[model samples]
Target chain A: MGPLIPNGIITGDWNFVIAILVGIAFGFILEASGFSSSRNIAGVFYGYNFVVLRVFFTAVIVAMVGLLYFDYFGWINLSQIFILPTFWPAMLLGGVIMGFGFLMGGFCPGTSFTAISIGKIDGLVFTVGLYLGIFIFSESFPLFKGFYNSGNLGHVTLTDVTGINAAWFAFAFVIIALAAFWVTMLIEKKVRKKITEYKF
Target chain B: MNTQTKNNYKPNYINPYLGGVLLGLLVLLTVYITGRGLGASGAVKSTVVTTADAISPTLAKANAYMGKFISGDRSPMYNWLVFESLGIFFGGLLSGIIFRRIRKPWVEHSPKITSKTRLIFALLGGIFFGAGSQFGRGCTSGAALSGSATFALGGVIVMLTIFGTGYAVAWFFRKLWI
Candidate 1:
């Protein structure tokens, strides 16, 4: 009944068209939310702005709950949905490296695209660096191929690993998001009072 | 700290909560339609493959990683993520036009640092993020956000580790942002 393309309700021919439309929406939402600005994004860590936290946590919880509801209504078959496979060591190392990237670059891959759209030279440079880095990785694949493919725990979900109902996990996430929103608001206010150079 | 600047100019972005809701719904709709989540880095990967393939088919095909993506039937750039990324650029451009943020290319950074310094850091950061995404199997959108929404264990693990590490190392790089 759902996941239209996967179930044959919609053919593959329309896949590319749909991809464009979805990506447009994704990009528009990101830019409109002030994510196009590196300063705005970095504010989450510095406490001057919590927009990243607010938007990210809200989106996560909303999608989490929405997926559960869709499953409940039998609108979408949960089994048909893609789940990212786990490779613990590799993922951990990747996350650590990306954290440094976020701190130094102040933009993730998606956000950098938006920044570039608005004529940010830094975004443009960052993208070139992305290309160079990927090229390096591809060339060096032989060196780490063994480790890259290691620690495969195929497509397991939190519910499967923790033995908790998905609904409970969703509820917990909502609570955490709400609390973070409140706390960050306070933190932003406090931090804003002390910072003079940046105005948002 | 300057009341004059604060009064004269106000940021015109949408509400964070509203933006979040829209983005989340979009994620749901994407999965409902395509059986996959949103991605950005995949497109870059595709482009890299295509470029390598063009430069030296032999070397590109010889590489363990790039070789897997090369197919005789179509260009690697013909993939879904590539089209989606094109849309992302256009969509971002549309938003920039609407918001009147489009401008001559310039570096954005803290007043304390020179633009040259910022660009250098940006490049280094991009390199790190690009390499990390390959190992992580996805970036924030593909792995962290979209993965967690589906309650995927890998998604949650990557999300936690990413933000956790950011928090841990953020202090050292405070000068870069603040």
Candidate 2:
């Protein structure tokens, strides 16, 4: 009933059209949330702003819970959904590198695209960096090929690995999100009092 | 020069919670429709593969990484993520136009740093991020968000590692933002 493409509810030719529409929605929402500004994005760490945390956590929980409901209702088959494979070592290394990139660049790939659209020079530079990085990786594929393919645990879920049900995980996330939101608010008040400029 | 207007200006961002809900729904819909999550970096990877393939078919085929993506009958540019990224670009443009946020070119950074410095770092960051995404199997959107929503263990690891690293490095790069 769901996953319209694989089940033939929607044909392959419409894929691009759907992609464009979905992407537009994604971009609009992201930009509208002030994600176009690196300063705004970086505020999460500085305690000046927590929009990134608020939005990201809420989105994840909502989606997580929603998936559970959808599965319960039999609207979407959970088995058909794609799960990103767990390549532990590669992901850890990649995540660490990406973290540095985020700190220095202040924009992730999607956010950078939105920033670029809004005429951000930094965003454009970041995109060029992305191209160059990929180009380098492609050229030197053999060098890190073994490392990339190592530590493959397949597509395993937290519930599968931890023996906990999905619902409990979702509930725990909601609680953690609520706690973070409150703590961030307190931190923001303290931080804002000390700073004379850079109004959030 | 409309000083009053400038001084009184307040940004028009939607509520974080509401935006989150919408984003969540969109992610849910994406999974429901395609049985996969949204992504940004994969599109760039496809372009790299397609471009290299176009330049040297033999070399592209010979390379272990590029070879996996190359299909003898078709082009890599025809992949789903590439089209989706194209959509994202247009979508962002549309939103920028609608909100009147599109403007002259400028670098966004802390007042402490010059535009040139910011741009250089941005490029370097993008390079690392792009390369990292290839190894990580997805970017923030594809791996972290989508993977986490599905309770995928790797998703949690990527998410924690990224934010953890961000917290660790945030102090050193404070001048760039704070």
Candidate 3:
């Protein structure tokens, strides 16, 4: 009854329109959460602002719980959901590189797009850099082609690896997220008190 | 492009927790409706593949990575992510307008560094991100956020590594932000 597209309730042609609408909602939420500002985003690391952590963790846990509940009610078939394939080595290298990107650029791809929409020059430059970087990667694909395709473990979830029920995992995440929220709240207070130079 | 000395002041954003709830529900809705979660970097990948193909059909087809994405029957740019990304731009614009956050073009960075330095880092960071996403197969929206939400092992791996690396290096780059 769920995943309307795969179930044939919503046709393929509607995917594009749905894509645009979903994207709009995604962009609006990100921007409205102060993600458009690099300073605000960078604050997650600096401890002055934990909005990034708060928003991200909360969103993940909520959705995680929602998925579990949906499956419990038999509203959505868990088997039909897409799971990202685990390519360990490639993802590790990629994650490390992206970490540097986040530190230097202060915006990820999605956030930068929002920043660009609001007339931020930094966002525009970062986006152009994205283009140039991808172009270079495309031209030199042979060098790292092996690395990219290596370590393929297929689409596996945490439950599969840990032998934990999906519901219990969702519950555990909620607890951890809540604990982090408290600790970060305290940290943000202390950090903001110390830092008067940077305005959020 | 709408650069002017506009929007000198804008209101604060919604509460983080509230924003998270809305975002979470949206993610749930998206997956329930489309059978897939949100993505950001995939759109950029499409752009790269489509652009390379358009520029050099022969060369694009010869490349190892880009070659797979190329097909003579259709343009790679016609993918869902591209259209979705276009909508993201429009959605962002709409929010900016409502919040009066749209303003003259400016570089956001720490006062410790010059704007030129900030812009350079931004570009370099973006370059790394582009390469990384191709390697990682997704970015924050696609993997860390959406993937983690579904309990995917890859999602957890990405979310941990990306943030762990962020924490690992945040001290070194303190000048860039703090």
Best by TM-score: 1
TM-score of each: 0.97, 0.96, 0.96
Evaluation by lDDT, superior candidate among 2 and 3: 3
Q: Candidate 3: which stretches are off by over 4 Å? A: B1-10
Pairs clashing within candidate 2: A24-B91
On residues A1-200, what C-alpha lDDT tens digit does candidate 1 reach at each position? 78889999999999999989988998899999998888999898889999999888999999999998899999999999999999988999988888888898898889899999999999888888788878999999999999998998888898888899999999999999999999999998999999987878
Among all windows of ten consecutive residues in candidate 2 chain B, which has the lowest summed lDDT?
A: B1-10
Residue B29 accuracy (lDDT) in model 2: 93
Q: Residue A98 lDDT in model 3? A: 86
- Report the number of the highest-DockQ candidate: 1
Model 1 error, position B61 (Å): 1.0
Model 2 per-residue lDDT tens digits across residues A1-200: 78788888999788888887788888888888889888888888788889999899999999999999999998988888888899999999989998988888888898988998889988889988988888888888789889998999999999888999999999999999999989998998999888755755
lDDT of each: 0.90, 0.87, 0.88
In model 3 chain A, where is the ten-residue run with the lowest total lDDT? A191-200
Off by over 4 Å in 1: B1-9
Put down candidate 3 lDDT per residue, A1-200, tens digits, no spaces: 89899898899889999999998998899899999988899899889989999999999988999998898899999899899999989898888888888998898999999999999999999988888878887788888888888999899998888898888888888999999999999999888998976765
For residue B144, give model 3's deviation from the true position in Å. 0.6
Q: Write down the lDDT that model 1 would get.
A: 0.90
